[model samples]
Target: MQRDQGVPQPRLLHIEADYSPAVSKTEPWVDLRSIRIDEYLQARSLAVKTQKAYRQDLQHFLRWTDKAWSAVTARQIAQFKTHLVRKEEGQRVLSDATVKRILGTMKAFYGWLWRCGYVDRDPTIEVQLPKLAEPEADNLSDEQVEKILAAVAGTKLCDRNLALFAVLQHGIRAEAATLLNVGDFDGQRLWVRQDKGGSKGVVPLDEEGVQKIQAYLGWRMSQGEVLLPESPLFVSASRRNRGARIGYDTIDKLVCQLRDITGIDFHAHQFRHTYATNLVLDGMNPYHVMTLTRHKSVQSFRRYTKAADQQAAEAAFYETKRRKRKTEPGSEQ
Candidate 1:
């Protein structure tokens, strides 16, 4: 009998392969841990939440298929997708959008595996993504925004709250707000470095905004804390002992705090919506508003432009007509 090098004995092979001809001596199975998902995601510079989501989705894909990931075929992937869409006990059927997200995770995993020499080719290249329904944007009323700002004004957390409000009022995203530094501001313009879609732009700062920031900076200087060029514009007082930078969580907490104080059920993104809605209501071109907000798609911004409330619209219409009548000759003053 001829012996195969680096191969298990016949008894071991039979048990390992489950006596299937497809699992031959020529092909070896690779385990999931060999892929190092964390390292791969880090190398790609994926966001923290993205890394977590991809790992979870890939784990689900692997657990569904008992075989090693490298041994999974395109047919098996299609079947797994079918399983996701079919409702069964202990198996929650995912929506089309969710299935697409899982497929994307699988594609990225396979692509990374191939690039790392763990696999020869990606099997998920042909997988299709599902179309997602556009969600309506969440916005707050002008009164609600004013209430939140006013609440911030009367708090000990004034500086941080002011910065957060500024970002919302200006329609900037959290990522852009987090990147802001002391040096990004000239006397007149705020230079947003690599904002949404990696585009740099300048937003003019109103006199009041400038004065508020100056006052905050002055207060910091009086306390013997000078903001360097590299210092974040909004630093957490709690983090002073930790030597860590102020993160998005701090900003989120401040927003929540303001909401609690003002009795407004609003999140940080609602601020951006309020800003965009106000601009559109004031007769600013949607395109110009888009430039200010740096929205990648016009459709994304359109969701923020709420249909004018019927009562408000009627009031404005009657008010305009009344003004016109009064302005005419021989009309009531």
Candidate 2:
């Protein structure tokens, strides 16, 4: 309290200060602090998978730098690259692609800090990047795909497996697949949530895919599972995990089971590659494929396109050789 004009007066409370009125007992305001790497990540409107990957990569960089963000230098950045490439017990700790990815994470993180005025400069601006090989898009052959479908058809959870396979056939990422709720689909279209830097769009569903999903839903109802708008489209079939939506690891195990049964070694991502390759080989417009695949850039879409071209060229070359051999005398049919 203060005396003003010979009258007692209550002191003015500064709004920005930590003090609050005692009468109401309201919650305190958010405590503002200095910028942090985690704060940068939280501010970013990145996809869940991208945010997770970037966080893991930044954590590795932080472990190496062993100092505050502002204290890091370009020299330390180079050293971090060397550290990533260094061998541990006669094996390289990180692959070339992984090293590049780590550098990318650093570039993004430091760039953010610089923009936020927390750092004087981006140390990663001049850091040399590892020369990475062109990514190879591995996909399954038609015969192998047929084998997987056949095995799933013969499985005990036939309806569930069929639905999963239909989803995989569309090249949907496992995370996006798991995030799918019952209302994410209509009879003919699927509303996909965005993946890493991907666009969210309604993709057309094949009749077979829709049918399999409906069959699985019907089976779930028969098993006393509640079918609601917010319910998971795909649920765990195991007793321990029953009625809960399948996770990425569980989906991985499901694909592994297919591999074991059919002796075809492949992962969920390979199915995506297969689907993209099929689109390219079938002469779908590149832009259309990019839109359907939700790829943000043509560069990513081209990886599948390039792979398809190589496969087509090899097929044509073998056909030419076959014709030449048949034209020659005494060639077997």
What is the C-alpha lDDT profile of model 1 across 1-333, one tens digit per residue? 878788966653343546545744666776656366666776775555556777888787767866765677888888877776787776657878788888888887888788888777677877677778766667787688778889888877687667557755777767677778889877676778845446567777667777777777677778788678877776667645432356778778777887778888878877777777777777777788778777778776767565433435888999999999999999977
lDDT of each: 0.73, 0.82
**For model 1, which pairs clash?**
none
TM-score of 2: 0.79
Best model number under TM-score: 2
lDDT of 2 by residue, 249-329 (tens): 887887888888999888888888999888988988768887878888776677889966887799999999989999999
lDDT of 2 at 202: 69
Pairs in clash, predicted candidate 2: none
Give model 2's clash tally. 0
By summed lDDT, the worst window of 10 consecutive residues in model 1 runs over: 11-20
